[model samples]
Target: MRPNRVSLVMSWLAMLLMGLAGLFGACGVSAASAAEAPIELRQGTVTTTVDGVTRTEPVELSYHWDRQHNGRPGTASFDLPFTLEAEPETPWGIFIPRVGNVFEVQLNDALLQTYGDMKRNNDADYAKAPIYVPVPGKLLRKGDNLLQIRLHADTARLAGLSQVVVGPAASVRNELFESANAWRFTGSVLLMAFSLIVGGIALALWLTQLDVDANGMPRRVAIYFWAALAEFFWAVRMADGLVAEPPLSWGPWGVLMAACYAGWAAASMMFVYHLAGWANERRHRWVRWPVAGVVVGTVLFSALSLQRDEPAWFTAWLAVELVFVAAFVGAFALATLRHPNDDRLLMAGAALVTVAFAARDWLVVRLSDAYGETTWVRYSSVFFGAVLLLIVLRRFRAAAVQARGSVAALAERVAQRERELAATYAELEAAAQVQARTHERERILREMHDGVGSHISSAIRQLQSGQSSSGDLLRTLRDSLDQLKLQIDSIHLPPGDVGALLAAARYRLEPRLASSGIEFEWAVDEVEPVEGLDAHGMRQLQFLLFESISNVLRHAEATVLRFEAGMKGKTVQLRVIDNGKGFDTTRVMPRSLAERSGAIGARLTVESRPGRTVVQLEFD
Candidate 1:
């Protein structure tokens, strides 16, 4: 399959899988209640040493102990008092919904379970969903049981505990399942998966739509490309919420997560601004610089946060993201109000939904002092991605419609051009026919001028000079008629064939030569035909031959005349020789014959001396 088609298929497949997961995830399967009784431990006492100062506090199981201590940073252990009616042989366990940093559960001063190393700077370990530790039945007393929890925490963060429960293994398992299925786990997984799939599709669409011009990529495509990158980074950052532990060290992971958040917000702002078509206006171009500055500032803050181990830098980054989100939402809303189009409206709705969820999560994180509880924001990304998909689909549909219209227009143009060409061809054909008729008439007139008219004029001149008698005049007229007949006969010879023209000339001239008491010798060699010997060229050649024979018969006083036509390579050679008392060639050759032979690309020569005379014509 083509790359675009493959990308489209995979995108659809991912969407289908997401839909299926959402469907299955929302449907809860009820399991039987735990086999043993359950108890909620709501009272405990927390003691700790900070800067070599000892402190003690009484805490409730349902409250965050970190708040009771004025949010101070320290290592502490919580001692809880509980009672067991009987030391049952069945397994008993404790379930804590959440914990801060590293902690260990001890049953009656015996280590039951340890989570995370207290010495390691594993801050993210506190963000885990729930902790379940199995209490050995042998360690459980028949009357009173003590459970201790040791925790390590950082400053300005929540540490200690939230609601703790003690029950049989089955009850603890059920509670753990319930905690894991909380909105944070399922929602983050869904959002991350959806973001990845949509990001892939968006990037693919951006690649396919990339238009390169002299000025580089168009601003609109660039905006969409950046939007895709933002979604991809958002997906990567959300992956941290899906896992129980950090994939990398806290410092690097913190930097990466911060950068991703900053990048996502910045790119989203740009995408919305451009999508609203405001980016095209000169006045709005300046807005992008400040937004870019904010993004760069956030990135630098993230790096500083990592280097200095300061959470304030990260908090500032979050504030920047919130400002970006607010601006993006406001811009989209204003665009929707101005344009009131379906696309703009959809984008506005998506932005509003995302911002609303983000605000709610922000409030929850601040009030509850928990990171894992703010999952609605991730879920909101689905709406945003859907809107982007719709936008791309609409663009594709519009392009397809425009393409079909262009093809139809091109076909109409081609048909109109064909009609015009047909009309032009008809006009050229008529013009050619008129020209052919004109040329034929001119050819007939020329033949009359050279044969009959010249002969008559010669006769009149002779008569006016009184150079010949009536009988001689009659003979000259008869010879003129014969010449006219020869001209007519030459016209009927096949074109481009030297031998046929030679035979026609001989046929016409033989009787006249024989009547003059001369023997006609006709010799023609079988040779390849010469091309481009048209009727006009043949007529000129025949006229030259006939004129030569006539001159020999009338004035040479010769009895034998020989005419030979043959091929010399690619040239045609014709020679007429007479054994007669010849005259000087320079005086006997006619200017008209020389000019006609030259016009037809033929070489004409006459050699006459003593009792021999020769006329030669060669044509290529």
Candidate 2:
């Protein structure tokens, strides 16, 4: 949606366009015709005075000071004497459609109104406006009345007065107001405000996009720069005309006006050229000379106006600037006609209309015979500028919307990629779990081979050799059973829990050892788990302890068995002690126990004596 104020302005502009014709038509009914007893439209004589050489011209319907007194600042007067039956009512007025840079009106030698002070400094140019003045009935004698109009012109200004209409104040009031406002009192003010606000916004946005445009490219920033430059100075030019009292004197004010025009024209040409695809580097290089000439000419004109007394220098520079404007307008119209688009055609038409009006105004200023004509460009350009402003706003809004769409599309792509990554992570996690389960199965098989298989093999060997009775075979088979119990118990043991490991082996062997008349003493101190011990390492230690017990039973001929496990100062020691008539020390310590202790990074030792024997594992 458009901003609220912009929407309101567009709606009002549409309404204005729809009623423009009717509005002007109603205003066209002149007061000279509208009065009941209309004042006769008659010829009047104009006296021109220049360099103290007074010249009187023939009476006509209107007056124009010819080329003889043109460039010099001069005075001109129009005198109209008429006969009336009676004195008119108190509030009679006259409407003159156009005057000069400044003027004063008098009836019967009494001053009625003066539009400007003619103070010789900081005076405004009223040549572009129409004026109406009310009259005092006392000035209208019953038999004769004299209406004199006086005007002052600047060094280059045209001195002219239009045909006058005398009637009741109401008769001339509306028409005069309409004609004056036609010179763009309302239109220029509105256009100036619109251009300033819109141009400021455009320039600010261009600053943000210093090297890029709404399409995220580098091309369109130039377009925005040109648009803002043209509009800003156009508002300045409009302000020069709109203000009643300029900050500078008339000469400097006019010079500033031309400079503003030069700036606006150059910027407008570049703006249209870029839009129409005529802004290649080669064309810009060719056009640069003319644009530079305009700038140089403006500076030269300013210098000359201050240095010299002639008005011709100012006029020449201004005319050169107009030629530049005409060339650009021609190129724009030709391009639009050759390959028309909606935006190009609209701008082309506006260019043609505005330039045509400007040309008429230039003619009225240069031609001696042209009189009573207000400036046309003052009105036409403001209206065309409004249309142009609307076009720019539409394009800017569209670009903004497209940029937003691009950002949204990029965000959607990123979100899709994140979802894909999340799914991939889940698949990887599942694969890792399957690999871990397979490794655990292999570890379980290795432990069962070392513990249960070894026990059963020892039982089979004793039976084949016939070296033991049925009781010995029974104890050997039971040891194999205890290995199975330890394996089953290890499945639920926490990682590196040595205490639970020792407990499992003790529980299974206690009953059998007690039945064999061996007292079992279990001593378990508060022990910390070994650092870096893993599931596989715990299984090795479990089987090693079971093998130690077998050694005590089979070889030590032990009657008392003691198992001790705990942390001792900095070194942890676990031992199995038996009190018996011991066997050979070398034979009692199994090679398997030695290998298992080395696997768990502990040392294995065995000591055998007549009264006692010990199998011990030590950890540093």
Whole-model lDDT per candidate: 0.73, 0.74
Which stretches of model 1 miss by more than 4 angstroms? 1-35, 40-81, 88-96, 100-141, 146-162, 175-179, 209-227, 243-248, 366-372, 402-410, 413-620
For model 1, what is the error of residue 433's alpha carbon versus the real structure, in angstroms, after optimal superposition?
6.4
Compared with the true structure, what per-residue lDDT tens digits does model 2 show for residues 479-553? Answer: 878888888887877767788778887777899799888999989886787775677678788878877777777
- Which stretches in model 2 have alpha-carbon errors above 4 Å? 1-49, 52-61, 64-68, 119-122, 177-179, 182-184, 190-220, 280-285, 302-309, 337-339, 424-620
TM-score of each: 0.61, 0.59
**Residue 46's lDDT in candidate 1:** 77
RMSD of each: 16.4, 16.2
Best by TM-score: 1
Error of 2 at 171 (Å): 1.0
TM-score of 2: 0.59
User: What lDDT score is found at residue 538 in candidate 1?
Assistant: 77
